[model samples]
Target: MADTRPALPPLRDVIARHGLAASKALGQNFLLDEQLLDRIAAIPGPLRDAPAFEVGPGPGGLTRAILRAGAKLVAVERDRRCLPALAELEEAFPGQLRVISGDAMATDAHAEAGDGAHIIANLPYNVGTPLLVGWLSAQWAPLPWWSSLTLMFQMEVAERIVAKAGSDHYGRLAVLSQWRSDAKIAMKVHRSAFTPRPR
Candidate 1:
């Protein structure tokens, strides 16, 4: 049979070549498993030719999966160590992947990814809530600039974001996060899935 997978280096190989260690300071972890990445990519709905943005795409693990799903992805990486690896992904996929080296929290998502792009990210615990809050608070009249957000968070944090109204868990954060968009748990990842499992 002909080799059918996209011609991209394995995540481990890319990490080693680039010395891409998971930095606790930068809130970095690499999920080397592509199967889970693909599943996460699917939660954004049909992305064939659609615009998508990813935050902190270390070594482009989930970035590859998102490109394979046919979404045009723009990924913002804070750690410059991973930029070369992402550059490889950009070359492999051509127009499908764009790397922005900066803080994701500061990105103008719509301006960077065109109007109304979907965001899918396995965010750092520190960045997840605040990024969502920023996006939620964004001023786009008539409708929000982002079409949807599919994010990964610790189970407890996810609960807080989706907490039901009138329930004890509900709070201002939950209301603000879900007010403009309908959020849900797209998938649960195994704790061991991350390169350096969080304690």
Candidate 2:
């Protein structure tokens, strides 16, 4: 099997070097656990030649994992502070990682990563719901541009994704997320897992 490891600075070191503090304004929380990131990356299977998209890849913890998993990636990060850190990953992976400097909320992920891209991200806390909703609102079934979306959302949002149609929590969000794929709680990520541990 090919090696699946990235040569880059440790997440904490990267954050420290960049003077990065999780910003409540941006809903940013740096997921520092490598094991958890690997699990998230595994959900999409071997990406092989398929392009992958990530939003708000703060400091590139999961970004590294995705590339190691053999994905050709286009990662959109709103914070310019992280560009240098992500740049290191781009260097490590050579041609594999393309870093786009922009807000994921306004960017069209499909257009950036192309059709049939697997969308995987830790997702910033503030925009996760709205971004997922926008992706779900696409005018087609099965989201022709997206292969699958493995993302992290707040507990309440995760509950709503898999909520049954008749349940009080069920609504448009449920319909939209589940219609294209079998949405499920892949894992539970606690606040303690974040670098700043979002409240």
Candidate 3:
């Protein structure tokens, strides 16, 4: 059967119409590469019956990929400017996509995700470290609710996360991340891929 839904607008057009640009203070960077988005979305373990939680889903690039991969998505976007763009994604995916407009830091992501959830995100560089720490920290009376996390950070940060105790990149992040959950650097995104290059 042929699909009858409307096609998505070009990413550039969506950005222009919504006045969405990279914000330095917000650590904004738009990842327009569809292939990369798909790779990021695929990082979470098998989707089968699990839900996917995405943090800082600017412009819904990764959000769309998650839906395309067949997992239900809950996108936590802090920037209000990108809400309209994310709304378009929700419409495209129908009931599969849920957009939460608020700071991901302030929200209890694990509680919001409920049980049997997996997290995947290309997090903002500025706040990525803290967010990861918060996720690993013991929360509530028992522990975190999610089963696993597949997230993107800068190359340096990625190394740190996957580093072993004797490795140069190993540090507090490695210790904490190892203690709570199994983690590793799934991939490395090139600087040219992002809309606004941050070196």
Candidate 4:
């Protein structure tokens, strides 16, 4: 079947068109690089036709890549300013994308994305750690709700997550991240990768 979806505007153009300036209060850093976004979306391996969930999908960059990879995506965005842009994505991808407007911290991701969903996101910096902890400790019947987690965090937090015992960075997050599942830093994103780049 020929893909009839309309061509998407460049990420920067979309941001400008939508007036989406990354909000520091929200810990927003809009990722505009398509190749990079595609790489991040592929971190959990093949997601073809699988269920995928994204948190803090500012401007839907990663959301586009997930859908392009053939996953059915459910994205939760706390920033209403980005919803119009996301709605555009919904039109372009049709049934492939479903977006929820609310705080990811409060959302039951397992309920929204269902069992075995691949949870992937750039993750808003302010709430990333707490959110990861919640998912890691969800106490499911057999396993956690999601099959895998591919998330982006600030370098310090990432280091903490993969830190070894006795290391200064090793602590509760490190234990939780490694206790039940294989955890590793799949990639490192430079400050330049984000708009209004992190300080």
Candidate 5:
């Protein structure tokens, strides 16, 4: 079926209109390229009619991609400045996107996304490892609430998560990620891709 909803404005335009400069304190780096966002959203495989969760959806770039991929997305965003931009997305993809304005660290993601949901995000840099650790630790019980996770991290952190047992980067993160599930480096995004290049 053809999508008849009104088109959303470009992400850059939304950011400019809203005065949403990436906050270093929040570790935000917006991804403006829709095609790249689509590829990231697809890393976890088919999202059609499935539930998906996103953390820190600045200006709703990845959120748009996930909606386009046919997922019912529940996004937790800490920055209030981005809510209006995301609201635009909510209107464009009605009934497909839900925005929660609060710290992702404090949010009950599992409850919000429901069971068997896919967790995908271009995670905020500072909290990325902490969030992943929390999710990885959840495996101590039965199966995790999420069916899969396809998250973006700095190159160093990415290596640590998927490093082999004998590799130099191998340690706690690798153990946590590999203990219960098959974890792999799904993709590597270049530094320049971010709105403000991460140092």
Candidate 6:
């Protein structure tokens, strides 16, 4: 039988239609590399039927990868500017992709995710550290929700997350992460991979 599903427009076209340009102040950097996003999505272990939570899913690059990987994705994006782009992704995936337009930090991901969910993202550099701390600390509190975290930060931030005691990067972040759940630096992406590379 011939396939009759609507084809997704090119990402560039979506970006252009929505006027979605990388906003430095908003910590926006559109990931142009599909392979990197796929690798990031794969790091949290098998998606299968598990729900995946993504923060700052600007332009839905990583969001698309998660959907393609066969997981139900709930993406929280802060910028209203990108909501149209995300809406396109929601259309592409139908019921599989749910996008919330709001501040990721304030959104209760657990409430949206229910139970047995995995968190994965190419975190916005501006809020990455604080968000990681929030997630790690949440795991130790009365209501730990997510089963795992597979996120990307700046290379320096990645080092800090996986750093061990006595290592140069070791600090409160290292202690908190180690004290809670298993975590690691799953991958490193180059600056050039982003639409507006950060320096």
Q: What does candidate 4's lDDT look like per residue over 156-185, in tens digits?
A: 999999999999998999998898689999
Where model 3 places Cα greater than 4 Å from the true spot, the runs are: 1-6, 140-144
Alpha-carbon lDDT, every model: 0.86, 0.87, 0.81, 0.92, 0.91, 0.82
Candidate 2 lDDT, 27-82, residue by residue in tens: 88888888888888999888877799999998999998898888999999999988
Could you tell me every candidate's TM-score relative to the true structure? Answer: 0.94, 0.94, 0.90, 0.95, 0.96, 0.91
Better of 1 and 3 by lDDT: 1
Candidate 5 clash pair list: none
- List candidate 6 stretches off by more than 4 Å: 1-6
Q: Rank order by lDDT, top first?
A: 4, 5, 2, 1, 6, 3
lDDT for each residue of candidate 3 in 1-199, tens digit (9 for 90 to 100): 9855447777778888898988889888888887788787777756754688899888877777788787878889989989989988888878788888898888777677777688888888788999888878846335567878888788888888878989998999999888887777677788899988878
Arranged by TM-score, best first: 5, 4, 1, 2, 6, 3
lDDT of prediction 3: 0.81
Q: What would the per-residue lDDT of candidate 5 be over residues 38-77, giving only the tens digit for each residue?
A: 8999989999999999999999899989999999999999
Q: Candidate 5 — which residues are off by over 4 angstroms?
A: 1-6
Clashing residue pairs, candidate 3? none
List clashing residue pairs in candidate 2. Answer: 116-145
What is the overall TM-score of model 5 with all chains considered together?
A: 0.96
CA RMSD of each candidate after superposition? 1.6, 1.7, 2.1, 1.7, 1.4, 2.3
Q: How high is the lDDT of residue 177 in model 3?
A: 83
The model with the greatest lDDT is 4
Residue-level lDDT of model 1, residues 1-199, one tens digit each, is 9856477778899999999889998777779998889888888789989999999999888999899989999999999988998898888887888899999878888799987688989898778888888888887465678788898888888898889999877997789877777867777898899998877
Residue 133, candidate 1: Cα error in Å is: 0.5
Which regions in candidate 1 have their CA more than 4 angstroms from the true location? 1-5, 140-142
